[model samples]
Target: MKHSLIFITISTFLATIILTHQTSSIKCFDHPNPLNFHQKIPVNCEFATRSLKTKRKSSNDKFQIKFTCGMDDKKLCDKVQKGFESAGQIITSTISIEIPITIDASFYDFCKTDNQCSIDNNVVAGGANPARTIALMDEDGVERYYPQALVKQLPFEHHPNFGPFDILAKFNSEADYWFEGDDSQIKPEQADFQLVVLHELVHGLGFYSSWNDFFDFVNPKGLTPIPSVEGEVKENMEMIFNGFIENIFDKYLVILSSGEHASNITTIINTIVNEKGKFYETPKDFIVKFKSSPQYLQSQIMLQTATTPFALGFLPKNANSPSEAIVLETTLNPYQTGSSLGHVDYKTYVNTSDFLMTYKQDSGLTLGDFMSIGGNYTGGPIGPRLRQVLKTLG
Candidate 1:
């Protein structure tokens, strides 16, 4: 009774660009291959769990963290574990989660071998994702994938196939990190390990997008669609996608120019699918027809909207107007897969209060430094906008 699940890992990177020039350019994009959704093989729910030796609960009893250190040094392992605990405590105190969430945290050298690390220039601080996801119906009567961590908070019946842990978090043990408890102690050249942990944990709680360019080769220029998971088999031996489906997070996304929801599959299909009620059966079939049809032009337009500055936004739940929408990271010219749609615009939020979710993080500056410049520092790295988003998602 194994079900195929799609997992997305959002990695935090220390940008190579200097702090002074961060607004103009930030090279924090993940390596293309690992970032591509199509390149990753689907994981089975049964085998997703990991065995960790140490376990600790947040002070508020809202989160239980199971941790393991792959690094050889015991002192370094203890520091990283403490960092994870500190991050979990921050999150537990901020949000009210009735069910205690369990996180599996691993501290390891991501680039120990030659091909282990993806990015050549920048150091990947860490990455995190939900251990599993369940396909459930949303308020609009549309079925969408919800992260296991979030699902536990909802009223839905507990999904039987879900793994023991809600979130799977991993950090780069080799990267230069400030492992001290105080944010003020973080050096300019070193990334704040606790801050990075907080950032990664949020991603695991479903701060990501499934609206990607997975089917780009079919219509290269303007191909950004939530690819149909039509062939995926579920644990009950049932097929998942009858048509295009989106993750729950995608429901909040809107095209700023047109004021249309990104999850409006009917409008998208009408625009790009040439024939009515005749969807392509497979990727190969879609490629043949798409290349020979005029529908690709529409796809190019879609891509344009995604890449254009201030074109895409996330409208909070029950918002008054589009003007209140939170701008997403769409300024990246050639749409860098992982860093583009899932993050806040780097240029817009670089030094602002919403800097936590931005695509690039500048090394050498502590969380306190960002709060000082941004003016309002309530607590942890979870900025105001990000906190609003997490609350809305739940």
Candidate 2:
């Protein structure tokens, strides 16, 4: 009965669709089919995953990204404390200077309670983290760490724009925690607590913008092969996620890419081309070139212009409402060809806000710098708040 109840809740949540546009009907908004060229191309997650995985294990000197601790151990905590202090008096008033780190699997086990916790979209997958609070600075000075589950049970949504914006980690499968401050899971040197703190601090601050993770239209069918151009476009998609853009994980970003059938790719691409500039616009069902013609890209530009004000908290409605946005250049179909099409879905939470911010400030910083800063520093207050609300639980 409990399992059935959980299934019902999950189904209802997945089936839920929130469209914020004032227009009565959903239209392409532009003509000439901006994504006509790449309509029927094959694409899949395994191909992209394989490519990314291969890149991770390659010997070639490609773009090698790594996370590093910002300050030396001696000043790490101090630097983080100071960052909190700069944000507001809340850091000193609520969180303490000295934090406690505890690891308990039992605490995480309790997070599965329906009333207490829900899956964290970020880590929901094979070997995923079980429910629990990985880290927390409570009202007292004590910073607590348990399995991921305990943290999942926290009552208040850290950000109001998104639902139950508590901090949690979704897992790929049943596995141990990723950051253990030990060499076994991750090298102690690689723990980068300062980096994590900065990232979370941004979540603590809140976000004022919205994002599209580009996972809605292209559902993975395992039959179609991801094209070479698709890989490059995917990287560009990431380019849009840098800096402050990553902070809005709490926003309900529509998955504009991904589909169970081949036509879904074209749908996503069309959306992409329709909403080119200004961020959060998509052509949904079109897959044209990144450097395609300007006229073809106008649809996207218009979509961006129309959506920008709402995403930036100037929508003339609820300032705390989750703004609408479209995902482009990625796939979300998570089923095999023989599997039911209904089971496949396109959508993912904003993993990080740096991509969007970096895109906004491309002229000022290198891509690597943008990523590094995104991983290391928390964005402004509003971005993190939005991130908490939009984040997905697998």
Candidate 3:
């Protein structure tokens, strides 16, 4: 099964890096030190708020990052704060934009006993941590209100001149993070804190897919993109909906074959569906035709129904590689959703010197030619193609 292959392949890949490392013994305190709540936002005061670094004036051109730490280990919080501050500086220096962006995020921890994590002050603890890899745009491929998480969690307010914080990441209180610099040798059991922070920050800055919208419910349960609306459609007579969206990582995507401009994930399905009204038995034979297919990426944003719905080449930065063509993950499985359609084509680029946005941080690779802008993220600057993609988004 596809699920089995994905897990086996990724585990085998990361095992090489993790198998050789060892964990250092650190003394454990009774409980994590609680963060001070003075000067914190009103919504959630469970964590204490601190301004790590306010590099630029509170203007539209600068970026502001507020670190809310809710952990017993003040030292770990300080290190994580420093890592984010470094990444924030790199983003600020990239271009002197007129509009400032403020990121309001919290880094907290939980107590893990045996194999389970105990709940922290925040509402939903243990089961899942609230490390939101957020996107400011509407995630639904359709009109609005795709995921319930977004509907209830819209920004309470946005600054006068600057936009709202695109990212709001929180961490588990008991998570083990490599606190030292990148050069520090990471044992098999230790995770590079800086590397993890850098990767999550990239996703927060719009390096993810809204492709999940296809499977998620549209405005309501009854409605579907059944007769998927490409441009505009009349739903139930009164409502006229325009399903085309122009933001998020998936929308700004450009296919390598120089075909039509794809604005959403429905173009391929819509094109093929229009022909056979169903999925092709053999998916391999459909790739070339899909690329050569006409300009129809704007038909429907939320894919209501599909026989075989899979993500396209949105994640593969090097789809144009002459060495070998990229193959996309078309089948959607619940277990593999995060690793599936949302990431780079790891199978194709794993062994090559291509993009580095796979499931696991292969932190084994390095790049030097492109760090002149701002000498930050020294150990792992954004990959060449990923950098290009980010620039294209702007």
Candidate 4:
């Protein structure tokens, strides 16, 4: 039940209505017409039990924006706890990376479960990673301590001041948000509660992937799918792995589709632990072993369109001219394992204006980067090629 990415950047606003949630009827994706939205703002309902926290700062910044509502309206949990304290003061005025963090959220009025994370417009409150995978190459490796990516140019090494707030998010108090209520901002026909709390706090701040803890460290029986026989799964199962990746987002994951950067994350987990072919014991879903290896899935879609080149920029489908090339859904769609293989395709940057890390936030584009696709928007708070792709991850 841990799969976060309904950002509505998983968004559509297409009102493909479907409701049902009580005793597990679960079927999200809602929208009727402000059955009730912002309802003329007036938060801090003063109800405090399950959750409610606040501690803002200024002169040198400080953070703490929490709120939890199971019921007892407190004005819809103080309008999404003051719209995540106004999206945590716009992510503390574009990052320098400070900790003592807490952006914890929860509302839940219904939409019980296709695995409980609401599912109407395909469940619109996903950003659930509690990412805690640290163990770069054991001197002992079993230690396990986590919390990285506060992004001051993070290459790796976290948990110092502690941020990545120990997970606690759940939304859908009957859908249709559109915060900043008494309206000063958040106006794009609403549904931008601080751009889905800055895209689920950027995967609870780690930009995600322990590759499902390396598929539960080589499928100790979890992601359930290894009955291969048809074409005998091979295109890079690299002979059914022994690569042992403990996840620092799999050391900057690379297949680079051979546009170069050859193969990363310890050379594709030691090229699937030194492949000798003729193998196949267990484990699956790296897109089912890269689609059973059709030339390593056309060299990993040619290294995800040669490293997300604005995903074939502004689609004439030329992805922005490498002599009219095109691939720009900005990589990682492989059937969405670990939240759309680490995000950014909100239908290929829906309408692009920084594209809140591409998944949904183009009410006409406000927060931006890709400087209209030439790329250069240091305005920060998550853009500029997703802050230069989370600074080449850990």
Best by lDDT: 1
* Regions of candidate 4 where Cα sits further than 4 Å from its true position: 1-179, 185-193, 205-328, 331-341, 346-394
Q: Each prediction's Cα lDDT score?
A: 0.63, 0.23, 0.36, 0.39
| TM-scores of all predicted structures | 0.78, 0.22, 0.49, 0.26
Write the residue-wise lDDT of candidate 1 on 1-394 in tens digits.
Answer: 1111111254223211111111111111112222222322234333222222123344476788989888789988988988888888878877778667888888877778424563544666667777665556778887676777787676433332455788777777667787766445665567777767777788778888765554443333654444443343233332222344567788888888767887774345445433523444444555556545565565566678778899888888878577777899999778666677788887888778888777767777666677677776665567778877888889
Residue 260 lDDT, candidate 1, scale 0-100? 84
Q: Give the per-residue lDDT of model 4 (tens digit) for 18-98.
A: 111111111111111111110111111111222112222343434465566787767767877776676656655655443
Which lDDT tens digits does candidate 3 get at residues 1-394? Answer: 0011111111111111111111111100010111110111112112122223422355433656777887677777788788667666655565233334556656654343233343341121111111222213333433221111121123323311112343455454454445545455544444445545555555545444434322222221111122212211122222111222233445544343442234434444444555633333222233233334452333232222211233345533434442222333334333242344334565554443333445444332222221332243443465445555555444
How does residue 382 of candidate 3 score in lDDT? 59
Residue 376 C-alpha lDDT in model 1: 69
Shift of residue 15 alpha carbon in model 2, Å: 6.9
The candidate 4 region of ten consecutive residues with least summed lDDT is 15-24
Model 3 residue runs over 4 Å out of place are: 1-61, 93-97, 110-164, 182-184, 213-246, 254-311, 314-335, 348-356, 362-380
Candidate 1: which stretches are off by over 4 Å?
1-59, 113-120, 157-160, 182-185, 216-220, 231-241, 265-267, 270-282, 291-298
Q: How many backbone clashes does every candidate have?
A: 3, 104, 19, 24
